[model samples]
Target: YDPKRTRFRNQHRGRMKGKSYRGNRICFGRYALQVLEPAWITARQIE
Candidate 1:
């Protein structure tokens, strides 16, 4: 998600339940997530 353009990234947030994350997933390392506040993140989907 690009916080600079859209905070919610096409309306996505919170926990995702089975078969949902396949297309919508963000790869943030444990340390990154812990260090970077979700709001402060400029983007998601690491890969």
Candidate 2:
């Protein structure tokens, strides 16, 4: 979906340089999907 107000600074490229400490472990399900690398999820791929 398109945003209402488009800013110049908000159109910058994304970087996966840092480490995430939060949500490293599963808290709900017995089998869960964890991502080792960064990726983009399209709306069509959700189904």
Candidate 3:
């Protein structure tokens, strides 16, 4: 994932800049899955 893009989203859409969203692990995990699954799958597929 692009650090710049993540930073932008965290700052703008995520509303999580410089603040502790640590209690929201489920939300963060879901967001991470949504962001990373495509690349992760493409890299691991056996076909």
TM-scores of the candidates are 0.16, 0.44, 0.14
lDDT winner between 2 and 3, please give it: 2
> Compared with the true structure, what per-residue lDDT tens digits does model 1 show for residues 1-47?
53577555566467633333243444664443232222333456444
Q: Please, what's the RMSD in Å of model 1?
A: 10.5
Q: Lowest lDDT 10-mer window, candidate 1?
A: 32-41
Q: Give lDDT tens digits, candidate 2, residues 1-47.
A: 87777666466567765445697788887987766777666899867
For candidate 2, the lDDT comes to 0.71
Q: Please rank every candidate by lDDT, starting with the best.
A: 2, 1, 3
Question: Which residue pairs in candidate 2 have backbone atoms (N, alpha carbon, C) closer than 3 angstroms, thus clashing?
Answer: none
lDDT of each: 0.43, 0.71, 0.39
Q: Which segments of model 3 are wrong by more than 4 Å?
A: 1-17, 27-47
Please name the candidate that would achieve the greatest TM-score relative to the true structure.
2
Query: Which candidate achieves the best lDDT against the true structure?
Result: 2
TM-score attained by model 1: 0.16
TM-score, cand. 3 vs. native: 0.14
**Each candidate structure's count of clashing pairs:** 1, 0, 0
Model 1 lDDT, residue 18, Cα: 36
Q: What is the per-residue lDDT of model 3 for residues 11-44, given as tens digits with 9 covering 90 to 100?
A: 3334323433356356533453223222323545
